[model samples]
Target: MTYEIALNKAWDKIAALASSKKYTVKYFTDIYEVRISDRMMLSISSDTPASEDIAILVLHYLTGFLKYGYNPKEEWISFKDIKGGQSYYPAYQENTIKPILEKFKEKTDDLISYLTESLEGRIVKGGDVTVELPTFSDVYIRMVLWHGDDEFAPEVTILFDRELTEIIPSEDIAVLLFNLAKRISDEL
Candidate 1:
């Protein structure tokens, strides 16, 4: 029976490790992934609630997968292809995609200034454009800002096409990104 348990032991182990993301909540199933997002949604805006584990599990396993070890680049294979995968986000040539592509390029440069690293994510000069990033975490942020006023809801989109950019935007994700930048900067 998959149920919730206080993630003391798991978190304890995580604390011993040098990682910032601690698995404090326990899942009684084989969680393939864990997401930190709004735990609940109310019909109205006044339904304010805290974020909680929106975990994706595999089967019966005590601990969920550790994303730290999961290379963000790997999940981006099909998203990088721009033409494959079971389902897809249409990149019609006629839409505002052209302008969005241009803006995305500008944003990539901005990220380069801070990240000091090269990634698969890039903005094509012309043609059908879609946001593809090293991690599934980055796709939404890329789209939201690029979409701007035309943006839909300006919130996270779980595009099942692939984990093109899952820029978690969580404390742990922030810490990881900063550390990654730091590590890259140190190399320079």
Candidate 2:
């Protein structure tokens, strides 16, 4: 189905579930805020409005949570742990990681700064620059970016909690990665 159709369906589901599910919806200035979790929040531009891509992401995220309910196991796992994730590993690396590595290269510090400032990403220890990205109410996607000098090529890793597979689909995960990378690139 087209994204528009999907968005409409998600809207219907959200509306239907909102009252019964007790979703927290609030208005902040021009933006409409939907607090999915303490850490994960979604907002829509009330005036000119954000792009449809972001709206769709929020819509899909809400719909997924409403359908599956939030019960994160609090444990991190690579995409390989997800269903059919092994087959999509190459795409995940190419679509999400390669571009970050290429764009950041020796400028890993800049990437960290952009992530923290623009995306509210929190730094972690593991890679040269690791950030925990809160994507949904119960979904936290961690991005580990290993900075490299002239001798080594920069590497990137995107990790998700094991419980994510129970809600979001593998294909949607790819789309999420693409959009997320695009968002980071836009800030760069």
Candidate 3:
């Protein structure tokens, strides 16, 4: 579907729920402020508009969360682990993973600093440099990077909370990661 159509459909779904109280209680406003990263915030309300891509992401999260409720297991799993994530992995790698790997391969320290300080991520144990970042309230994405050796090229893996599929579909997850990779790459 076109982004505009998808956005309107998402808004319609949220409107059908009748009240924004649930959202306000969780996010502090009916406008539904969403953090794309620590430095980026998008408001998901008619009065406070956003770009179609961002609006759809915010609204999709709101609608899906309303329907499924937030219940993160705190278990981190790779994108391939999500339902249908395997089929989507090739495109995901090209769109999300490859860009990140290319950008950060040589600037590992810069990447780590950006992830930790700018994005409010915390360094974790894994790969050469790993960080777990909160993409939304209580929802985290883990990025693991392995600098290349002579035998292999550098690699990057993005992971999400295991229960995320219960809230948003794999398609939305892919968009989220794509946006994230773009955002981070753009910043540094």
TM-score against native, each model: 0.23, 0.75, 0.82
Report model 2's TM-score to 2 decimal places.
0.75
Best candidate according to TM-score: 3
Please give the clash total of every predicted structure, in order. 13, 0, 0
Q: After superposition, how far is residue 33 of candidate 1 from its true place, in Å?
A: 15
In candidate 1 the C-alpha lDDT for residue 149 amounts to 47
lDDT of 3 by residue, 54-173 (tens): 667676777777788889887889898988988988999998998888778767788888888877889889988889887766677889888879999888988888888887778889
Judged by whole-model lDDT over C-alpha atoms, candidate 2 comes out at 0.66
After superposition, which runs of candidate 3 have C-alpha atoms over 4 Å from their true positions? 21-48
**Any runs in candidate 2 off by more than 4 Å, and if so which?**
20-46, 148-152
In candidate 3, residue 136 scores what lDDT? Answer: 63
How would the candidate models be sorted by lDDT, starting from the highest?
3, 2, 1
lDDT of each prediction vs. the true structure?
0.29, 0.66, 0.74
- Model 1, 59-163: lDDT tens per residue? 111122244332334332322233332232243211223333343454544543332234444442222233333332322213222333464422211121223
> Candidate 1 — which residues are off by over 4 angstroms?
1-76, 80-86, 91-100, 105-108, 114-188
- The residue-by-residue lDDT of candidate 2 on 55-129, one tens digit each, is 556656666676787687878788777788889888877877777777677566788887777666788877877
lDDT, candidate 2, residue 84?
82
